[model samples]
Target: MNTLSYGLLSLLSFAPLSGYDLTQKIKPLWQAGHSQIYPLLASMEQQGYISYKLIEQTDKPDKKEYTITEAGLAQLRQWVEMPAEHPVLRDELHFKLYSLWLSEPQKAKELLYQRMEFCQSELDRYNEMLGGNETLREERGESHEPKATTFGRYMLIRKRIMDMESSLQFCKYALEELEI
Candidate 1:
C-alpha cells in the first residue's frame, strides 16, 4: 500500500472522519494536501479498505464520513507486524553541511543557529502536545477504540521528539567544532 492509503486507514480506524477533518489531523504529521488525500481515499475505497457515508449538512457541503472495513483492519494489522519499508533520510540541511567548506564560517554559523531554532521550535511543540496528552489521559482516562487507534501516533510523536533533540544537539556540536 501507498503512504496515503496507510495514512487514511490509520485515521479511519479511529473514527469516521470527513476528508477535511483528515487533512487537518495530518497537517502537523505529514505534508499531504487535499488534492492528494481525496484521490487516495477513493482508491482505497475501491480496494475494499474503506467506505463512507454522506452526511447531510445544512450549514455546509455534504461530508463523507469514512470508516475502515474488515479488510482495512486486517491490512492495518499486517502493516503493523511487517517490517517498515526502508526509512528515507533526505534532508536539505545535510546537503548544506556537506557544502560548508565553500561557505564563510560566519555564514555557516548563522545557518546552524537557525537550524537550532527550527529544531527547538519543533521540539517545543511536541513537548507541549505530550504534556497535553498526559493531561487528557488524566482528565478523560483515554481508552476504548480511540486509544487503541491513536497509540501509534503517541509513539510516533515521542520518537520525533527524540529526533528533534538529537538534531538540536548536532547543531550545537557542529557550531562548536567550527570554532565559531
Candidate 2:
C-alpha cells in the first residue's frame, strides 16, 4: 500500500497519460523517479489495477496510454477516503542522520545545511509551478483557462510541498541544536 502506484492510479483518473508524461508530471512534485514509475506501471498492469492501449499518432511512434480500470478506480476511491497515515520519512534521510555520528560534527552540520538548501530550492520550484502557470495546463492539452479542478489539485500539491519544507526546516533546527 505504500507503493507510489496509488498516486499513479490517481493521476490516470484525471486523464490517460503516457508513462513518459506521467513521469514528467510526477517528477516535480512526488518522488516518482523514472526508474520507479515505469516498473510500477508494469506491475499495476500485471495486477489488473490499470490497462494501457497503444495510441497511434500521425507524427510519432505509438505510445502506451494508461487508463485506470474499474478495479483501479475502486481502489483509488478507497485510498483517497482512507484516513491519512503518519508520514514515513525517507530511509535515506534516516541513514544520513545515523551517519552523523561517524563524521566530524561540523561536517555533519554542513551536510544538513546542504539538505536544507535543497529543500528550499524544491519548495521555491513547487511554489512557482503552483502560481497559475498556464503552461502546464496548455501542455496537458487543456483548452480552457485553468479551472477549479486543476487549481485545487495544484493547491493540494502545494500543501504537500509546504509540509516537506516545514519538515526540512525542523530537521535543520534539530541539526543546529545538535551542534552538528
Candidate 3:
C-alpha cells in the first residue's frame, strides 16, 4: 500500500477521526498537503479500505469522520509484518556537511555551529512531542502492546531525539577535531 494509505490506516487504527483531526495528528512526521489528504480519503473510502460518517454540527458544516474497515485492518497487520523500505533522509544540512571538506575552516565552523543550534531546537520539539505522547498514552491506558501504533510513534520520536543528540555531539567533535 501507498504511504498515505498506510498512514491513514495507522491513524484510523487508533480511533475514528475527522480529516482535519488526522492532519493535526500526523503533522509532526507527515508533511502532507491539505489537498493531498481529502482526495486520498475519498479514494480510500471508494476502495473499501475505509468509510466515513457525517456528523452534524450546531453552528458549523458537517464533519466526515473516517474509520478503517476490517479489510484495512488486515492489510495494516500484514503490512506491519513486512520488511519496510529503507528510509531515505533528504536533509539539506547533511548535503552541506558532505561538502565541509571543501569549505574554509572559518566557514565550516560557522556552518557546524548553525547546525548545532537547529539540532537543539529540533531536540526540544521532539521532547515536547514525547511529553505529549505520555499524556495521550495515559489517557488511552496504553500498554506495551506490539500491535498498537502508539508504541511505534513513541519509539520513532525517541529515535529522533537520540538522533538529534548524536548530531549535536558530532558537530561539537568536528569543531574540536579541526581546532576551529
Candidate 4:
C-alpha cells in the first residue's frame, strides 16, 4: 500500500467516515481527492485492512462509512513507530518566491500581498476550527488536554495555525524589505 493508503487508515482509526468526509478531512494534511480515495478504500477493503457499513440517507445517495480493522490498526501502529520521510512541499508559491529577484519591485510586492491574503484566509479557517473544538470541549466540561481520540486533531490544527501565522509574518517582513 502507498502513503495515501496509510493516511486513509490513520483517519479511519480516528472515526468511521464516508469517502467524501475523508477527502475533506485529509485535504489540509494530504493532497487527495475522491478520485484517489475511493479506489484506495476499495483496495484496502479487499486486503482486509478496512471495512465499511452502508449508510442510508433520505435525500442523497447512500454512502459507505469506512472503519479500520485490527490489521489496519496494527499496520498503522507499526508505521508510526518507523521514522518518517522528510515532508515535501509542492506549493507553486515557493517557486515564485525563489525567482522573485527577477521580478520588478511592484510585482514582488504583489506576490507577497497575494501570499499574505492566502495565509490570512487559512489562519482564519484554522482559528474557526479551533474555536469550534474549544466550544465542544466547554460544552462537555472537558479539560485543555483533548481526549485521546481528538488529541491529534487538536494539536494538528494548532500547528497549522502557527504555520500560517508565521507565513503571514514572513510576507509582512518581505513586504517591508521591499518598502511596500
Candidate 5:
C-alpha cells in the first residue's frame, strides 16, 4: 500500500471518520484530497482492509463513515514495526532563502515575517490539539501515563509544537540577519 493508504488506515485506527473528516484530519501530516482518498478507500474496502457505513444526514448529502477492519489493523501494526522512510523536505521557503541574495532587503524581511506568522499559527494549532487530547484523556478517566491509544498522537503533537517553536526562532534569527 502507498503511504497515503497507510495514512488513511492510521487515522481510521483511532476512530471511525467520514471521508470529509479524514481529509481534514490528514492535512496536518499528509497532503491528500478527496480525489485521491475516495479511490484508495474504495480499493482498501475491496481488499477487506476497511469497511464503511453510509449515514444519511438530514441537512447534507449522505456520507460514508469508515472504520478499519481487523486486517487493516494488523497491517497497520506490521507497518509500524517496519522502519520508516526518511521524511521528504519540500518547503518552498528553503528555495526562497537560497535565493534571498537576489531579492530586495524589504522583500526578504517580508518573507521572514510571513514565515514567523505561519510558525506561530501552527504552534497555536498544535498546542490546542495537545490540550484537546489532555481533555479527552481526563474525560475518559485515563491517567497521564502513556497509553496505546494516545501515546503516539501525544508525542507527535508535542514534537510538532517543538518544531514550530524552533522554526519561529529561526525566522527571528533570519530577520535579524537581514537587518544587519
Candidate 6:
C-alpha cells in the first residue's frame, strides 16, 4: 500500500483522531498538506479501510473521528509482517543542489548553508524529543525502563536523528569543498 494508507492506518491504530489532527501530523512527518490528506481519507473510506463517527465534544463543534476497520487492521498486520521495500530516497534538496550551478556560486553556497541550518535545527528538535535522560516513558511517569520492543523503536528513531546529523555534516563539508 501507499504511504498515505499506511500512515492513516498507523495513526488510527494509536487512537481515533479527527481529520484535522491527522492532517497536521502528516504535514511534518510526510510533508503532505490538507489537499493530499483529505482526498486520501475519502478514498480509504471508500475502500473500506476505515470508518468514522461524528463526535461532539462539549467544548467544540462536531468532528468526524476516524478509526481503522477490520480490513485496515488486517492490512496493517500484513504490512508489518512483510519484508520492507527498499526505500527510494527522493531528496528535494538534491534537486536544488544540482540546479545551483546555474546561478552564482555564492547563491548556491548560501542555499546549501541554509539547508544545513534547517537540518541542524530539525536534528536538535528530534534529539530533544527522543534523546537524553528524559524520555516518553519518564514524561508519562511510567517505568524508567521500557519494554524491549519500545526501546528498539526508540533506538531506531535515535538512529534516524544521527543519520540526519551525518547528512548535515556532509552538506557542510561539501559546501566548503565547493568553495561557495
Name the candidate that leads on TM-score.
Answer: 5
lDDT winner, 3 or 6:
3
How many clashing pairs per prediction, in order? Answer: 0, 1, 0, 0, 0, 0
TM-scores for every predicted model: 0.85, 0.67, 0.80, 0.88, 0.92, 0.76
Residue-level lDDT tens digits of model 2 in 53-147: 99999998889999999999998889988897787666576787777679887787787787788888877777777666775555434453445
lDDT of each: 0.85, 0.78, 0.85, 0.88, 0.90, 0.77
* Worst 10-residue lDDT window, candidate 3: 139-148
Candidate 5's displacement at residue 10, Å, is 0.7
Give me the candidate number with maximum lDDT: 5
Segments in model 4 whose C-alpha atoms lie over 4 Å from true places: 135-147
lDDT: which is higher, 5 or 6? Answer: 5
lDDT of 5: 0.90
Q: What lDDT tens digits, residue by residue, belong to model 3 across residues 53-123?
A: 99999999999999999988998889888998898787887888788789998998999899899999999
**Which residues of candidate 1, in runs, are more than 4 Å off?**
134-149
Off by over 4 Å in 5: 136-146
Model 5 agreement with the true structure over 1-180: per-residue lDDT tens digits:
999999999999999999999999999989889999999999999999999999999999999999999999999989988999999999999999999999999999999989899999999988887776665556435564565577777778889999999999999999888878
User: What lDDT does model 4 reach?
Assistant: 0.88
Better of 2 and 6 by lDDT: 2
Residue lDDT tens for model 1, 28-129: 767899999999999888999999999999999889999999999999878867777787877898999999999999999999999999999999998888
The TM-score of predicted model 2 comes to: 0.67
> Model 3: how far is 150 from its true place, Å?
2.8
RMSD of each: 3.2, 5.4, 3.0, 2.5, 2.0, 3.8
